[model samples]
Every structure is written in C-alpha cells, then in structure tokens.
Target: MSRSLRRGALAATAIVFSIAALSACGAGNDAQTLGVRPDNAAVSVDDVKIQNAVVITQPTPGVKGPAVVSATVFNNGRQAQTLDAITLPGTSATVKLKPAEGTGPITVPAGGSVVIGGEGNATAVIENGTEAAKNGDAQKVVFKLSRTGDVALEAFVVRGSGYYKGFGPSEVPAPPSATPTASATPGGEHGAEHGGESSPSGEASHASGH
Candidate 1:
C-alpha cells in the first residue's frame, strides 16, 4: 500500500476511536440519573403555621366525584411568599391541588391572603392531606410564602367524611366502609369521637390509593 494511503487510513482509524470514546462517555453520563426535584419541592413543618383555621365543608353526600378543597394562603408576616407545588407524603400517590389547575402559581401577597381554588369547585384532585394526616407523617402544605422562605404549612386535610389533623407520625385512618358514615355524622359528633386521632396510618382507605 502507498505511504500516503497508510497515513490517511491511520487518521481515519484514530478519528473512529475518538468518536467511540466520546460516545461511551456520553452514554455513561446518560445512564447516571440526574438529581431532580418537584418544583417548590421542599416538604417540612417547622416553619409553617395554621394562618387560617383548618376548615372542612362537606359537599351534599353521595356526590360521587373528587372532593373540592379550598384554603386561603395568608402571609401574616410582613414579607412576601411563594408556595411550592404541593405533594402527598407518600411514594407514588396521585393527588391534585385546586387554583393551581386554573389560576396557576398562587402568589400570596405580604400580610394578605389569596383564595387558592378554581371556579365554582375550587381546585380538584384526589386529596392526600387527610391521608398524610392519618399516616401521622409531617402534615404540611409545601409552599414558599412571600415572607417565609420555602415552607410546609402544618396543614389539616378537610374531607367530606371528616378532617385529619397532622402532628406526629403516620395515622391510623378509619376503615373504608366507615369513612362515608364517619363523615356523614354531625361535625360536632365526629370531632368528639375522632378528635385525638390525627394521622395517616400509611394505609390505603380506598382503591384510589388515598
């Protein structure tokens, strides 16, 4: 073979090897998972407060649909705040928050409160606050208030059946057969009966994984 041809072939071989090495490096990087987090993802309870009273309003019973919940985000402090997107305190739980669906990124003004919910029905989603409360996990609505830096409000999930006050570890939730009846009972009675029972027992109350 000609000397010139040999040099050309060597150069081609070198280029092929270099390309292969780069490709391998790229693949390795791709194989390595990137650190990711949900937006406003910090979940905690130390800094949050019940700025507004935890309220639970029942939809007329037998309404066969996702419950609608509304909460007012008030920045009682002087500074402005931003709410991180909300999440359930469990793995692989599917839920939703209202106002977020229609109004989007709820920005609470300093020393003021904004109603977070959608039209008519507020934000709709399978709620997990009650579940989290029942489980006794850190009960919080993660968000960044204008005044408070990233925070998770000590929250209570208001359900048609009843309410869950989050405080300690996971809760011992009421049974599925009992939830509807439990909620339907008079509010005062329900409170008296399950007043001290706050938490998500980390158990599924229904097939919805709630």
Candidate 2:
C-alpha cells in the first residue's frame, strides 16, 4: 500500500472514532434529561426524607387565606419518628398537626412513610393566621421532627383546585356575608299606603279651600 493511502486510511478511522465519541456524549446528555423533577419541594434530613412538600392555600387577590401542608414523610431508621409541627418563616401562622389516629403526634413507622394531607392520612393545617402566598409561589416550610430536628425547604404554593381540590385546611373561615342594605322604600305596600293617604289629604285640603 502507498504511504499516502495509508495516511488517508488513518484519517478516516480517526473521523469515525470522533463521531462515535460525540454520539456517546449526546446519549449521556439525553439520559440525564429523561426524568422530570417533582413540581413540589423535597428535603432529606439524616434518615428522614420529606418528599412532595407543598403548601395548598385558598388565597384571594390581596387577601390571605387558610393553608395546609402536604408531604410524605419517610423514616428509614430502625425506630419510628414523630412529626411534631410545621412552621412558616416570616409569618405568624401556626401549624397544627392532626394524626391519622387518635390525638397524638404524627408518627412515621420505621422503614415506612406517612402521607400528609392525603385521603385518610395525617393533616398539617395552618390555622388562625392566614397564608399570604399566592398560587405558584414558593413558601419556606420548616418541618420539626422528633429525632431529625428541623428540616426547612421552600415548598411550592398551590391553590385548592384541580388536583388539590380537597387538600386545603379543614377550617377555612367563610367570608363575611354582605349585610343587605335597607331598601329606600321599606315595602311596596307601605309606600303605596303612604301615597294614598297623602293624596287624600291634599284633595281634602283643596276642597276645603274651595
């Protein structure tokens, strides 16, 4: 084989290898982008993992409303862990936890998980002080655990609609009913009677003058 032909063959092999390398890199990038992250927030503290942490609020425009915390608490330890309370930063809102059974702290069993704000599950409500967070906003939520301590993360705020229709706080105060205004004419019958009496009085006065 000629030296020039040998050099050309080596160049062709190098091009093929370069193309293979690029293809591998592209596949790696595609694999990395395969899965979508959860829309809600999540945090792991030691053996405790808080997944799908979200705040569902019933807020109106410019008015704060009641809210609830929804998440799944997973305990990977050997013993059960209790969720004490959840708190919001920079707000006076108080978080009240309602266990699934009895009036006790929410407990996640060992090597198991507890769902919050789910059907027939534990509930964490933000009572009294309303949540001012609007839909699609991120609010900082601090989860207090028995052993893991406090794990704070910015959870996404969603409205109590669609997928979260029944996830709102149990005790959302109803808006004040508008007081009915006193009608200018109290009753049609009363106004008619007054008109009739006034007309008769005017007619009698005119007859007397005549």
Candidate 3:
C-alpha cells in the first residue's frame, strides 16, 4: 500500500479501538449506558376481575350533581399489572369520572388484586345506564390497555351486578367462612370420642384398660 494510505488506515483503526473502549467503559459505569428506552418498556394489565363495585356518592357538574362509583380489581394472573391511567367512559355534560389519588400505574401482585372504592375517588369515569337516570350503578371501565408484550392495545371492562349501591357506602368485608376456627366434636364438646378411647387428653379410663 502507499505510504499515505497505510498511515490513514492505521489512524482509522486507532479511532475505532478508542471508541469501542469508551463504550465498554461507559456501559460498565452506569445503567443508562445499557441502551434502555422507557417508552419501549413493557407494561401489562391482565387477569382483571372486578370485585365489589359500588357508588358511594355523586358528582356535581355546574348545577347538576356528580355520579361517583367504586370497585375492587382482582389480579388472577402470575404477572404484575401496572394501571397506567383511566379516562372517563361516556360523554355527558352533567356527568364526570374522577381519578383517585395515586391511581396511575398501580402494581398488582400475582394472584392478587387492588380494591378501588369511593365513587368520587375513581381513577377514571364512564357513563353507565341511561342519561335521564344520570346514575351509573355500573359502567364500563376500559383500561389504558398495555402489556409487557410489544404494542399497547385496548382492554374492555366487563359488566356485572352487585357492584353498585345507594348513597350509603360500606366496605365489603371478607366472607366468614374464610376466618379460622377451632375444631369441634360432634357432641358439641371440644374433643371426639371414638371406640371408647375417650378424648386424646386421657380424661376417661376403663377399669381393665381394655
């Protein structure tokens, strides 16, 4: 090769090596150097089971009253669900859906869900039932709809009964059967008597030990 051409090639090779070394060093020093993009990060909402939805209060739009609702979200999947945000469901000048505090991007653990209550404290709002009634015993809560997989899609909210109540609001406590209780005997006593063995406490004894 010509003298000038060889010198140019050598200089280019040195520049490439220096760039590679800088890249490696920077990557090792900080996580930002890993070339991660927040916009491309995976976020999903799945296994969304609505539990105990209720309307605690109503909203006030100008002279019109407000429509408030509440419900619990159950996560029945193995992965965590991050609720990005919620938008009002229907178009009613008099109606509005309110977003609760810390409503955006909530993390629900696997095999678990979060309970959303208080009509006035909803993450988003939607129109339910007829406009004349101006009351949503139940409305469609469409999720922002994103998943760990590529592309953020749309998700629909299923309709179910027993999710709404009147102005009176009460927490839906767990079922009584879920509570733990002590074992009992058939005779209403503490222990069971089988084959004259009496209780395990050895309270009753036979004369011959038989």
Candidate 4:
C-alpha cells in the first residue's frame, strides 16, 4: 500500500480503539459501581433526613417482645429540631422515646445529626412489637418531629444478631407472680373439725360418770 494510504489506515484503527474504550468506561458507571445500598430505610421531610432506619428484634423469629428502632437524623436547617415521638401504624405496639441526655426530647442539632438507638445514644422502642413484626419483614415507622411534622418510612425488621447484636430492646421485667391466700387452703375445714367438738371418748366417759 502507498505511504499515505497506510497513514489513513492507522488513524482509523486508533479511532476504533478510542470508541471501544469509551464504551467500556460508560458500562462501568452502572448501579454496581455505586456499591451496595444499605438494607434499611431512609426518608427526607422538610429539613430533616432520616437514614438507615431499622427495627431490631430478638433473634428468635415470631417471639412476642419489644423491638428497638435504629436510625440517624440529619438537620439541614439553621435551627435544631426535636424528635417528639415515633409510631408504628397498623399495630397495637407503642413507641417510647428515651433521649440519651436523660429525660427530654431528642434534639438534632442545627446542620448536624443525631443517632437513635445507637451506642450511648437516644432510643426508640416498640413495646410488645414482635407480635406485629418478624425477622425479614418490612414495617412502617413514623417519626414525629417538632418542625417537620410526621415523616414515615418502611423500615426493615432484622434479628438481633450479626451486625445488630446489641440493637434489640432492653430486657423487660416479668410480671409478679400471684401470692397464695389463706382461702386457697383447707384451713376452714381443719378449724371446724378441731374446734366444733371434743373427743368422742371424752364425751362418753363424762356421760357415764353422770
């Protein structure tokens, strides 16, 4: 081939290689490249963002007990926000909040964040929860805030094992046992037998003497 023709062929080969490389790079930017998304739930309402929300229960499946919620709340506004309460819809369970700073509402600092049910952090518990939820289930949780109103999300229910070993609800005290009463025994019958009459032999001897 002539020198000019050879140069043109080389340029065409270089262009083909460049196009193939560009296609490969585009394919690499798919969902897998972003890494694995968290298995928990997340939601944003107004200036508040709740992320990685999950309900953790006892490791035993279907066991009736309390469950704890874990999440991080981010406040993007200039003012701090208070987390008032949490609720589980379509269930009889009640959600109780316990702030890490003792007895008060949980506060998400301005332009900062707060963690719920994390180590040494505030807690949100679902009383008598496992009956309405089980491991591997999706439960609807509502977070009531002072400024953002109510933000709801579908949180995943996970067993308190593996990465969530300490996320389960605190130990609940058992109800007191019923005490025994005097009426529960045969005390009345025994008293009647001993007090109502003297011995039969004693009574007969006294009648003979008379």
Candidate 5:
C-alpha cells in the first residue's frame, strides 16, 4: 500500500470514529434529555426542563401585588413526573400553584411536556411581592421536581401590559356589564296613570271655572 493511500484511509477512519462518538454523546439531541437549554432563559435537570420561565409584573411599583410565573416544562425521561413547587430566591414573592385536577403537582407525561402561564390550566402564581419583582427585571427561581432534584434558573420580569395584556394576579374580575333589556317607559305604568288622573282633574277645574 502507498503512503498516501494509507494516510487517506487513516483520515477516513478518524472521521468515522468522530461521528460515532458524537452519536453516542447525542449530537443535536432533544433539549429535555440532554439538559441543554434551548434559550439562555431555559434550564433543565435529570430530563426535566423548564423553558422561558418568567414572571409577569403588575406594571406599576408600590402597587404591592403578586407576579405570575410562566414556563413550559418538558419531561424527556421514560417515566412520568410531577412539579411540586417553584420558589423565587431572594424575593418576597410567595409561590402559589394551581395543580392539575386529581394531581397535587404539575404532571408531565412520559416524553411529553406541559406549558404554564396560559389561560387554560392552572399555573404558578407568585403571591405577595411588595417591590422586589419589578418590570423589566430578572428573578432566579428553583423548581422542585418530584423525581429530579431542584432546577434553578433566572426568570425575566415582564410588565403585564401592551403585548402582555390581561395577565396579572388573580383578582375579582370586573363583572360583565348587564346588557340593556327592553322594558316599559322610564316611569313605568305609574306615570301613565298619573297623567290620566291629572287630565281629569284639569278638566273638572276648567269646568268649575267656566
């Protein structure tokens, strides 16, 4: 065999080995399993990943309100898992979670994911934040997983207005306006009776005067 041929063959073999190694290491693998967060705002641990975790602010400071946390939890493990709670470190905000019906914690199906902060299902509610979490700020929080350990990451603070309209702490939503109902006149039947009785009295007075 020629030296050039041997060198070529060696190069080919090295390339093959490198490809195999990357495959074993899961090149371009799913974010959940690899614990490789997609965005800088994302974090994962033990196949349980939370992406885009954020706190929706109450817009104005000194209002003293709770901010809501929104994130998409992905469980890449073979078994199902639950999210027990999430805590914001170094902040006055308390965590309030609305668990899935019949499940105490947020449940993630095997190989499936669940998205929080939407209008539908229960989500993490950050209660009693005085002035810590402000608009355009970032807060670090730790997620307590049922199977996996704590996964901590920074969550951005967004004002719940304009693009983030309609998101805030749970409040007594303003009651819908009552639609105008078709009914009688402004004074009802009493005014009509009064007008009729007044007309007769006026006629009697006119006759008495005549």
Candidate 6:
C-alpha cells in the first residue's frame, strides 16, 4: 500500500478498537431495561395488528368502576374501520369505546392506529369488574365491528401502582351482623342472676302510707 494509505488504515483500526471498548463499558446501562415488554405484547388477526396491548387496572375494577385497556390498533388494510364494542367475556366488565363521553364505537383512521386507554385519556372503558379480574392474567377479549367480523385477542392484565391504582376493587364496608353480648338479667336484678324475693325493708312504702 502507499505510505499515506497505510497511515490512514492504521488510524481507522485504532478508532474501531476505541468504539468497541466504549460499547463494552456501557452494558445494560439504559435509563430502564425490563426483562420483557409485558405491556408491549401484540396479537394479529387478519390484516389488523394490535400492538402494545395491556389492560391496566388496580386488582379489579369494582362494580361500576373502570377497567381500562390501552393498545395501538393498526389497520394494515387499505380502508378505514370502526371498533364498535369490546367485551371481556372472562370478566363482568362491559367495554366502551368512548369513556369520557358515553357513546358508540371509535373509528380507526385508514392505515393508522388508534390508541386506547392511555394516561388520563381512557378510550376503551370496562365497567363492573369482578374478583376474577386480577393482574398477570391473559383476559380473553373480543373487539366487535360494524361490518367486519369480531376479532378476539388475549389482553394482559397490568396491575396499578401509582396513577392507575384507583381501578382496583374497592374496600366497601360489609353489612352489619348482630352479635350476642353479656348483659345482666332483666327487671332490675343485681349482679346476681337469680335473687330471692325482695326483703321487707326493700319493699315498704304502701304499708306506711295506710
């Protein structure tokens, strides 16, 4: 090789070695590294691909409470579609496409994704969840449509810690039940349960009046 070319090659080798050393020093030093993306699971049926799917709630979204699920539903097809209803057959919670305002299904723009149940914006809402609604379980959910057929997906149950903890089952007070307690016998009885007839001194007033 030429003199200048040989020097250029040696400099490039040193730079490559330095870059490798930096990478080795910074192993697993990201801001946050999770074992697996539990919330980033995806399921595809037909041309529809649902990504980052997770049902976020406390433990259970109590009766009339909220069972929120978030996901990015992508329409790989050429046309637009509307998500009519979402149902959790494994749970009692009914799905709503519009949580803020009670309404019908949400529309998915053509070749795009619709984000449901994000932070502060709860799009698909499930009401009236039961004890069976727990965390770390795969819930069998169905997404209904107007024209297209229903699509079933396994949505994971993500437990709440900070912001989404309110959806857990409420600690409602149980109804009061009667319980027996110790009490003295009726009719002015003393500490003793059974006492002899009243003494003459204890029963006097009428004779004195006569």
**What lDDT would candidate 6 get against the real structure?**
0.53
Tens-place lDDT per residue, model 4, 131-204, is: 76778889998989898899999988887656565556654322234233334547967654553233111000
Residues 35-109, candidate 1: write the lDDT tens digits. 111211223233333233222222222222333223445455666566645444443334454343356555555
TM-score of 4: 0.63
CA displacement after TM-score superposition, residue 3 of candidate 4 (Å): 21
Model 2 ranges with Cα > 4 A deviation? 1-37, 59-64, 172-210
Residue-by-residue lDDT tens digits, candidate 3, 134-176 = 3433334344424432212222222212322321222222233
> What clash pairs does model 4 have?
none
lDDT of each: 0.39, 0.68, 0.37, 0.70, 0.62, 0.53
Query: What RMSD does model 2 have?
Result: 20.0
Best by TM-score: 4
Ranking by TM-score: 4, 2, 5, 6, 1, 3
What is the TM-score of candidate 5?
0.59
Each model's TM-score, in the order given?
0.35, 0.62, 0.33, 0.63, 0.59, 0.57
Q: Please count the clashing residue pairs in each candidate, in the order shown.
A: 33, 0, 15, 0, 0, 0
Cα lDDT of candidate 4 equals 0.70
After the best TM-score superposition of candidate 6, give how far the Cα of residue 208 lies from its true spot, in angstroms.
93
Q: Give the Å shift of residue 143 in candidate 6.
A: 1.7
- lDDT computed for candidate 3: 0.37
Worst 10 residues of 4 by lDDT: 201-210
